[model samples]
Target: MATAPAANDNARPSRLGPFLRSPAFGLVLVALLAAAPAAAVLLGQPFWLTMATRVAIFALAALSLSFILGQGGLVSFGHAAPFGIGAYAVLILADLGFTDALVAFPVAFLAGALFSGVTGTVALRTRGVYFIMITLALAQMAFFTFTSLSAYGGDDGMTLWARSTVAGQKWLKNDLTFAYLAIGLLALFLVLGNRVLASRFGRVFRGLKENESRLAALGYDAYPVRLVAYALAGGVAAVAGALLANQTEFVSPAYMAWQRSGDLIVMVVLGGLGPLHGAIVGAAVVLVVEETLSHLTEHWKIIFGPLLILIVLLRGGLIARILGGRRG
Candidate 1:
């Protein structure tokens, strides 16, 4: 009798199980991304390649946020701190005569991870709105600290004299090569993020989101696991920041601003707030929409603010209808 019941349970799949398990969705997304550069080249629109690179960078940053916010339920409002720190890391290294990506990128990643680890130790002690406020405060402290660095151009920002080189080669100086590099990094991390989220560590981290008490009862220490996830997210966001620095050839204290963090949050939420791919979609849509709206009017935010609210209100139904899944 027990065997028959277990068989019946196994036979009946959850409503969203197929949608989640299907590879068609991810394959389509990857194919579309891989085609963008080629399409731009064939169409003779180099600007599109630049735009695609920008989208990829932001998507990577947003994906990092999703790793914590979506999977671990750690809402970090100060995410831009690590991002800006990464950008500045490149600038600082360049000042020290290290303009190679091989040298700068890893340093930037470590800087970001270190900053996140130190701050998350304290921030994780709080929960809910308190956590958000603490992160914002910590990020503001970083922002002010950067502004005080007159040697690095202070509040006015500084421009990179040259983009980082690839193995002492000037490959990154070419827009096409740089765009592909950004896309390649995004693809690599997307795979890594998926793998991390599927591992045992991911299971426990997500459990932190769903029920900390239950997990603690099961002999799990939430602090160390959450800190590791937070640090990893910060490191990834820093890499995106480094790419952004390369793309713009500029670094600013403004990158560490609370508003920048809010923009990151918007990207994650706009992208559907859970899946990493949603961050990519959200970054692309937000950038495209911002560009379009800016052309339409200088007061674009006046229109965008309400539009975002409406989307947030309707996102659940819209997503369920689009995915053809029962709303859980």
Candidate 2:
């Protein structure tokens, strides 16, 4: 009864193949992030807890960019405008006696949304390279606007006297608590983004990306829809900015520099632009690599530049492999 084994049997895929292909892979990424603070404590590397918090904040920013860029086909080079606006929202609010996250966060979100909505109304009217340039110009305008505000320390930047509290409690002052809070926010946004992408609105947004002409023919006015999505993305990014301000206890014009927006784009590209979770992975990888390289030498970018070029040359195969999916 011993039949010869089929030739194809040996080619059976590993169990990991399915897991990697499944949505659970994204969950695992989130779980690892959630565990980072505790793991850092266990290893006696408390600095890593701070690093994880930074990673989570940047991931949120990148995820927001991914929302508009990946789905709506709106590549905003001025995305940092909202981010910077958010930080300033916190700074202004705290200065005016609103230091609670409960208050500052919503204000930051609305500030970001308002800025994005106003600028995106014009920026989204263009397409291709023109759109990119407009966003860059708009963001630079914001950079200079902030730099000229001498009252908020302008070019020198300003420091927060104390971190924003959680509902009037100083709970966020604790490193571990802050790290977990950041991770929790990132997880919540990832879930919401996934849901949005699966909804009818997401379908139209995606259609706008694939063929706006077709969507237009179908009687969908792409402008308002794109504008709404842009504003939402900006709002989310502003929240990240608020979190960043809290984490560093500082706010500066540089927070929303054009370069920061470029970094967000890179993170989205590095993560393959398919799933929002990839932004989390991309943010972690970029920050960790930069951190490691800086300790080795002052001119980290010399190494980083070529390394990034190689990654781009490879067109994100490394990320795709790790994420267990094809790049979008």
Candidate 3:
């Protein structure tokens, strides 16, 4: 028995030999994951933690956009609609005395999925610029509808009196705990997204992105696959929106504004697209840059606007190349 145990332990090392050999890359990844949270905790700065939480939330939203734009080859300009809807869903639920995260989150996801299904059916009918325009229009419609809802605070936005509880516990009331929870969700979604993109369904989506007509000739229905992906992306974005609402303790039509949708796309592109992790990097970069630039000047847009153009022209392709070099 002792001899057998020694042999089994030796085999276990051999099984992991390849992974252990790639120590540098693994170590770097582990360090990167640990650095942000560790810094936040060590610094003991509430503002930095809040900013990091905001970045994670926005990154989750950008990741959702990447699923549709980068993978599904769907340029949806209305992505913010689901995000806003999810936020509003949480707000509404809180108002209705259902402030538990366990309840609010699932409800927000379902609402987003349902909205995506209905909106996708209409928006998917067109492709290219038409699709973009239609999505933008649909998002505008949603924004206007929200603006008219006087009961929910409408244009002025409603403040959330409290954050959602967890299983009758006020766990999320703490900013630090809530921030870690947001990070956990971001990591969870990223892993789930990676698995999804490697699955058989992901293969079909990639094929469709490469050539939809060829996929159809091969007896696959591209529309349904794309629609399902679109809905799933919307659902994920809605989850982010719910978190955002809880973080800010506010809900308003501005959440669904067209500029917000554009910002999401910008984050996706800046992060190099396709890879889920890129979204988080992009969000952090954009937010940090914006914060720094804003602090530097009251009219920072005067400087930031041209700088962004230069980045799009020069660094955009470089980012894509660095992040797997897959073009949409």
Candidate 4:
């Protein structure tokens, strides 16, 4: 007792420290990324605005993946299933003459949730490499199933004749309107995800990731928590997909390809796992790099692949370099 150290010995630093070091850095990056499209619009560059729309859509998808893969330590390679389903949901609904965003978006989200809920229940039965393989297999099943559907574009994909109407308004068809919608929805999801991470459920899920046995020993069933996170992540990814279909005015089986899932994983790792918000940063970086490098060389992957390896090998990559987080 006499040797006990003062409780204040481990007191935290001033608020300004974390703010200046990591919080502010992250905020600045987000602002710049969000503002890029607006700047492009102001400059009369509609192409860049469309590009920004892609960035925002992927940002939302990556953000959702961060929840499960980043915080919950669930390496799900089947996330693309829900994403592609969301796109198809929108397409199918529109094909049925239900083109209203208000109706279509919820249906898309529910479709994603339904797919993830079923898949997660089974996928969570295994762990490590087995989990990864199972996820990949399930996703491929979806890919082939969609490919067999000759009614729609099937393997060739389909072009949307029109964007979703918002409350019967056709503004969603406008590029600028869609861009803002994507950006605004992304920001909302990011904020919502941040809140969830701070909640008790998030804490427990993270703890399960760190030591599932320990959490289970403490009387918490890890299955439901992981399942919920998995499903929620899928639903969110689906939202991104819906926006993507709106942005591109197209839907395809390609959206569910394993390659896309791998790309999502790359974004999570590239952004670093500490705050998870870095997922958006990673998406922007990946998209921008791909856009830039593709123009410079036809074999961009030959260049991009090694760069990704380098970042993952580095100490927590860009987020660590800028934000002072521990290496992953």
Candidate 5:
């Protein structure tokens, strides 16, 4: 009888291995970095630049969710709360004369962290569908709260006339420069997320994802670990939200709506969850498809809905195993 291969031989590489070994990932990153500058110089179109930046920003948000769903096994339906809160943080601070990027970014991050900690405390206590529903409900609360802030735009939504200034510089005011800055932030978060997945804390998070009971029995307090991971994910998502407000020069309760949260989840799953880079791919695919479909027909949703269903059914798992193999 033929002996089965050793378990180690069939095992997935450590999460970091894909980043270190995959030439394709490196090439894509380099291409994206190069494209930002090329688009500015060659195209000279503000519309294209803005669209690209938006893709990057949302990609960052999706990546944040991947950390929780892909690695930590926490399906937070309220992830958009931090994202919207981050956007609101920038706008609220901008309204109060805190237009500096340095100040706005930190404030946005803090808001996300605080929101996550409070929500995670309750949601984390439950598992499966209960956790999902509680998070969705909490996000709705945030949405309603934002709508009630009349001093801000309230239901009308607020428009930012200018992007935040960096230091004493007007650098971010330039569309191309701002796009580069957004890309840089995306790169930073992607690298940091990869590092986290390689650390001891990340190991525990992944363990919990695979088997919460096993991790708990192994003497690890799964709650605190998951909570920290959730908070970190929220903070990272907030960073994306902050950049988003800067990119669009606007803020609204729509940012925190349940639909936005659902879209974030779609991006994570579409990109092939767990691998940080997959989020970027998924975002690109979704945005490109949406734009294309919208141009072809006014009721794009009629076509887009079926397309998404088809993609999900054909793709099977979150990430396409046939194309990328399993995430490290």
Candidate 6:
């Protein structure tokens, strides 16, 4: 039988590997993926530009989820609550004529912080399945609450007259520019996330995932650490939501539904939970498969269903397995 490595063996320092099998390679690949739309534009294919843009947007969201779910084993099933709140922040403010990205973006971050602050406090009191259920409940509450708001078009959702302006300029309305913006933000967040994961806080967070009791024995308080990580993840997810509103130009209560949260989890798992950028690969694969399948048939999910299962069974994930090399 294949046995897991000893803790000491797992603790050995790591080094970058071959181009085809390194985390650095995966990141470089992601950068090229970001540039793909520009290449498509050169080829006179506007449709691919739009699809690549969506990949950037969801990649941001799934990247946020990766911080907690992929890195620390914090299974937050309510990620969509903050994500949807971020979208609604843009929509509601735009409806009130506050369409500047500066104003709306901050509001979205605050909204996510608010949700995470309240629910995370309560959810952190539990662990395992209890924690998962609490997160789901909180997400559903946000969903239903938004659905009941008739002023914002309730369950039907609201649309924006125009994309959020940057410094009072309509830069994002341009498809190519918007794609670049999304890619830029994704890169920025990826850098920020890497710092967080590489820091002492991240080590402690991962330690808790392995053994909370042992970490506690070492004098680290899990509550505060977990709470902070959860809040940060929520804030990041909300930023993704804000960008998504600009991409879709719509906000609906449906964004916060439990199923969307599940999709985020799927993206994290599909990308491979080894490194942070795995989520990017997962997001692109999910969106591309979904888009391609949808065009082929109305019941495309039936086809996608088996395909996803086969993927899981065959390789678990593409980027983490191939680019990241064999898992420890």
Using all chains and alpha carbons, the TM-scores for the candidates as numbered come to 0.90, 0.92, 0.88, 0.91, 0.89, 0.90
lDDT of each: 0.83, 0.85, 0.81, 0.81, 0.81, 0.83
lDDT of 1 by residue, 82-118 (tens): 9999999999999999999999999999999999999
Which residues of candidate 1, in runs, are more than 4 Å off? 1-24, 315-328
Off by over 4 Å in 4: 1-17, 20-30, 325-328
Model 6: how far is 49 from its true place, Å? 1.0
Q: Candidate 6 residues 187-287, lDDT tens each?
A: 88888888787799989997887788999999999999989999988888998999988998988998898989988887887776657787788888888
Q: For candidate 4, write residues 1-328 as lDDT tens digits.
A: 0222232332344564376334445556567767878799899887798888888889888888888987887888877888899899899999999999999888888889888889888999888888889989999998898888888788998988799999999999778888888888887777787778779998999898777889999999999999998888899999999999888889999999999998898877777655666777778888989999999999999999998778766535754445433334
User: Model 5, range 17-69, lDDT digits (tens) per residue?
Assistant: 56533535834763675496557668777567777887888888998998898
Error of 4 at 3 (Å): 34
Name every residue pair that clashes in candidate 5.
272-319
Lowest-sum lDDT 10-residue window in model 2: 1-10
TM-score head-to-head 4 vs 5, winner: 4
Candidate 4 global lDDT: 0.81
Screening candidate 2 with a backbone cut-off below 3 angstroms (N, C-alpha, C), the clashing residue pairs are none
**Lowest-lDDT window of 10 residues in candidate 4?**
1-10
Badly placed stretches (over 4 Å) of model 3 are 1-34, 315-318
Question: Where does candidate 6 clash, by residue pair?
Answer: none
lDDT of 3: 0.81
Candidate scoring better on TM-score of 2 and 4? 2
Q: Measured by TM-score, how close is model 4 to the native structure?
A: 0.91
List residue ranges in candidate 2 displaced over 4 A. Answer: 1-23, 321-328
